[model samples]
Target: MKSPLLAIMLALSAAFPAVADVLKIKKDAPKQYVVKKGDTLWDISGIYLDEPWLWPELWQMNPQIDNPHLIYPGDALALIYDADGNPRLVINKAYRKLSPQGRITPKGTNAITTLPLEMIKPYISYEQAIDSDDIKDMPYVLGANENTKTQTLGHILYVKGDLKVHKAYAIYHEGEPYTDLETGEVLATRASYVGMARAFRTGDEQNGVPSSLRVESVKREIQQGDFLMPAMQGQLLPAYFNIHRPDNAVSGHVIASPRQVREFSTMDVVVLNLGRDQLIEPGHVLDLERQSPTVIDGPRGPRYPEDSSKFEKLLSDASQLFGDESDEENTTWTMPKEKVGELIVFKVYDKVSYALITKNQHPIRIGDIAVIH
Candidate 1:
């Protein structure tokens, strides 16, 4: 019979694997390192770990320090092992010395972000996905005060809808609709942000009076019939969060590319078919795979032969090879999908979510598959 302490240890080992497989520290990882300006958590983790997304597991939080997760510039990190020989990273508080005034100050005021803010700042602040049913009820531009076809910054525009006084709104234009390829369902429509506007006077719907709004900024010329949505206020971006694989087996396809490019690479924002309904949340890392095309094995004729008769004969032979299954089971076979890259989910909607490509070994296409890493 096993003792109670031994049974508990067995249970823990079965539940949570060792740091060697989960954390997997790199062979060339430094014993001690200093934090620097413009350094992100992902980049720092890559310096010490083979899988940077597993940084949260390798970090050992010190309860004595305030906000231990917030690592600032000049702070030193030391890689140490516990009694069980499990690797962990901890902050070296003794790295800095007291100043002449007997006070210790950090080199930088701001804490390092989880990912580069410059890459996803615009998408988080300006870009939005709206449902198709809600678009018709949204406030739209009626006209401009200057009687021009298009409006710019400092131009007053008239909007017809329920508007609150002293409220800021983002001007947007309708873009392409995102659809689920498997389910044949329209998830959401992409909103093209054009400018920012502030409402000074409220509109009276009973009197048919339009509200007055002043355009404060413009990325593009604000045209008539542009939609209006509430501007994000005091929205905090994700700075420090636990990175982990999806709890369940979640898989989806890349539905839309915001950059309007055929192929996308690292740092490019792409929309996935999975969302909150599918239990997808921010900070979840996913692996990307590109499906291989099916190849047909048949008798080869000529390379780009101009003779029409030769081409016909080749086509007939290919069809006969495909139809005849007496000797072989099938003439065509699909190759295995190749793993291309990885992406991290940052923003999620109801049926669709926005993810930034973090690692790209190959150019990701529109229909690439994203599965839990």
Candidate 2:
């Protein structure tokens, strides 16, 4: 049987706006261009506009000319003015289907993806962000396989938790803690996946029985002290993401990623603090906003005259800065959050979610805020 993920990827569609508007064209942009194989909309839009994420604002998708399935190697994109003199990408009426065109086949026969889906595939599928409350109380590994430093697939492991029946669990190691930017409180600890394990037997402390686990799969070396969180038996992130903007407002923070990197960019996988409980779902587009510091100082005033005392002073020198905490008027200045990029949530758990950085106006970093686009 064919894999369902492939089927979903084959049928993925692009989302567009209903109305058109005047586009803010970049100076010295090309008047016309031809779409080629492996050319992405991101790359093409960068060639025409200052903000690549604004492509939908000016791209007039002529359903008559373009095949919704894919942008092939020979499609021509021309810059033209509409009747009202608004600048728009001229949408052709026909895709130049040849005389040999025949019966339409299933989506995957030879169709290309609407966007460069390959870049974020593995991240969108395998990566997940977990909250502390979701996994801390779950089963955890004590040690097994002779308490060896390294453990591989198909090895026996021991876990310490209450298991009523035989089942499967995801093995992982905890990463750094993600703190709430607003309250400065610890929100959750990120989970770095290690492997997958199946419960073979339950260890009974009263009866002196040891819990036994069989490692089904290993993403990394399974070692002692790793965590085992309950997960669906055969679930995986699906390969379908319909480009869209959420109707509701979503506000969250960047919690984690595969690595402990502090910053992220295009195609990077990030875990947002929002999740299933917040009504988040796959294909929900959000904006990554960079929060500016609140302590910008004003221009310096004339400095006080230096003390002329020749004898060494015991007291420390103080600048007596103008913007002091006690002074309310000139103490602080803040700027509005800037939209740095667009993110697409791929997976959602109880209190956390996994997302991919699709479009970036600026480099995004940890603690950046995510709001519905």
Candidate 3:
């Protein structure tokens, strides 16, 4: 038989097992947390770090916390003091919400917008796909000036082409790719925008041929599985047709190719192959590069002494008599120089976008590479 004191001691020893696992973690409790429903473990981490990018770091330390994506209600986030007494994120159940903020509150949020699809399709340049037999059989068309823009591409414009009746084709604006500095990634290019064609041959000769075409509806609000087919050749700016992407993408492939301002007409739009999908947001800055003319010495030879020959004497006479630097400057400045233009990405999309040439510092043209900053 055990003594009364021994019995009491044994009972306390049995209870110690439960008490030890209870975890006195008052020092390891999180200081603050905003209540939100359907918030994941990654989402909470983003809020604490003030950087959504640090979610991966928290996952690295906690292995028992499986499924980094799930975080249920009443989840506790504790801050533990390390050996150096530095506070860090250490999970503990003791850290609970005193009063849960329920749903039906617009406490913290913003108006949300979904990403736009790539409205434009890709075009296979002659260099890409060659129809060997049809060498001169280029896709071309002529249309009456139904331009919406009094000067620029506005509301709607239609071109007539030599397309077969009831034949479906695609229109594409071959654009350039952009880069993302945050991820060091290359974004895809936007190609042709497709629209159904209700082809009709009026047999009306506008410029000596019976090639007249009417393009019906145009492509917009793009999705996957969209492609481009041959359409009547006509000049068009793809920008006027669709809403620009919300953000300007700063990421693009490194482009050093020299481009010139081909279309000098005012209100001319230069199209690019970057959009919302590239992480291009509005108000992004793009730099344009201009190619300087190469200086070439034309007919350089030893000039006779100033007083010896008429040519030398004439030169000396002109320099002393005129005293104008105009001739000397004109000789160097006369070379043809290629100029480039830059603009801010005011509009964006998943794959296609448009920009405005800011301040008209330099004239922008087709084929000019817009490097995002």
Candidate 4:
């Protein structure tokens, strides 16, 4: 028989392998990313994943990201693997400097930042008419006088109605000067949509006079209660617009503006109402409301196109004659899947801002919901 002590030592050696081979962390463990000025999470994720819209997946693994509000320059992102061999994200805490000696401004009152993919959420513009049945619905005219231009573009049908508000409406011809990202310079000229305005009068003297409007360039009068708001034209810069209001329920205090619903072009561009003032710092993460695609059955008649008809006949023959061998699984094919677009808050203004669609796997329409992650 073998010696008792030797047998015990041999058994222990088989059980523990680390002692035989040293365990050490790799010199190049996970990659570290440094945040640069003007960099958003949308752009950051583009560097890592093939699809940037999958930024949310990072949070599912790492909990360091608390909010997606503001990601400033100098912040570091460390990615490593855990014991289970899964990718993990960790934030290296660094002391912020008050007066760094570069063009980048030192951290300010609004310099609060979050982890890799934390608190970022998207809010979509949802609509509900004040006294109407459906949205994008033209309200009927009770009466009319004349002080506004009537031009119907697509869904908006303008007619002269009673101007309900008596307060003098300030005609905002154009917005203030803003910095242009492309030129890296301040642009003095305003965008064309910001048109000029003038005030008029309407309504009775008993309850107070109602105000009306007239367009100078277009040359038309706007009667009482005419809707005045922006409509969808083409591709908007940001992916979507978010409405923020305190009193509403569908969208409570978290919305970017107080509007009921948002409009957008076929592309996933949008305009968020919340800007620099509404705590909407740059680099925020906003969640998108994913929507599934609708399916419709095709007509079951003879095909008009020769190619399609031949193909259909072939399929019919295969289904009836071959019975089981003609790839039966694909007999019913699904239409393309649609998911809402995921947007990343990139630009910020005083009362408005812009977001970019990080991922457009799904077709994001005009009125999807956006919320903070």
The CA-based lDDT of model 4 is what?
0.38
TM-score of 3: 0.26
What overall lDDT goes with each candidate model?
0.74, 0.62, 0.37, 0.38
Minimum summed lDDT over a 10-residue window in model 3 is located at: 110-119
lDDT (10s digit) by residue, model 3, range 1-373: 0101112222223323322222233343347553344443223433554322222333333434443322334344555444544334434534433434322234222111111112111221210111222212333323323522221222222333354655544444333444343453444443444453444443433665443334455554222222234554422323211112223335332121112245533223344556666676553445554445433221353333431445444544565457645235211222343435444454455654555443244555454555643
Error of 1 at 103 (Å): 12
TM-score of each: 0.81, 0.65, 0.26, 0.36
Per-residue lDDT of model 4, residues 1-373, tens digit only? 0101112222222333323222333344448766665454445556665544333344333455543334446656666666656554455554224324322435543232221222222222212112122212432222234333433211122223344342222111222333333343332212223222333445453554443444433223332334433333211233222212112122101122222234432223355544555677444555566334322222453332342445554664565567646635324323442345555554454544555445554555444555553
Model 1, span 1-373: residue lDDT tens:
0101112222223333445554568999999887777777777877987667655555433233333335666667778887666677776656555323222334344666777888888887777788988888999999998889999999999997988889999889888899998888999998888999999998887899999899999999999989998887313476544455777999999988888886999889999998999999887789999887645443442222233355444554565566654323224444788889998898888999999888899899899999964
Question: Per-prediction count of colliding residue pairs?
Answer: 0, 1, 28, 45
Give Cα distance to truth, residue 341, candidate 2, Å. 3.5
Candidate 1 positional error at 340, Å? 1.2
Off by over 4 Å in 2: 1-17, 20-118, 121-126, 161-169, 198-208, 229-235, 255-257, 276-279, 291-333
lDDT tens per residue, model 2, 125-231: 34545567766776778878775887898789887876645787888787777666677666566666788888888888567566788888988998777877665
Best by lDDT: 1
- TM-score order of candidates, best first? 1, 2, 4, 3
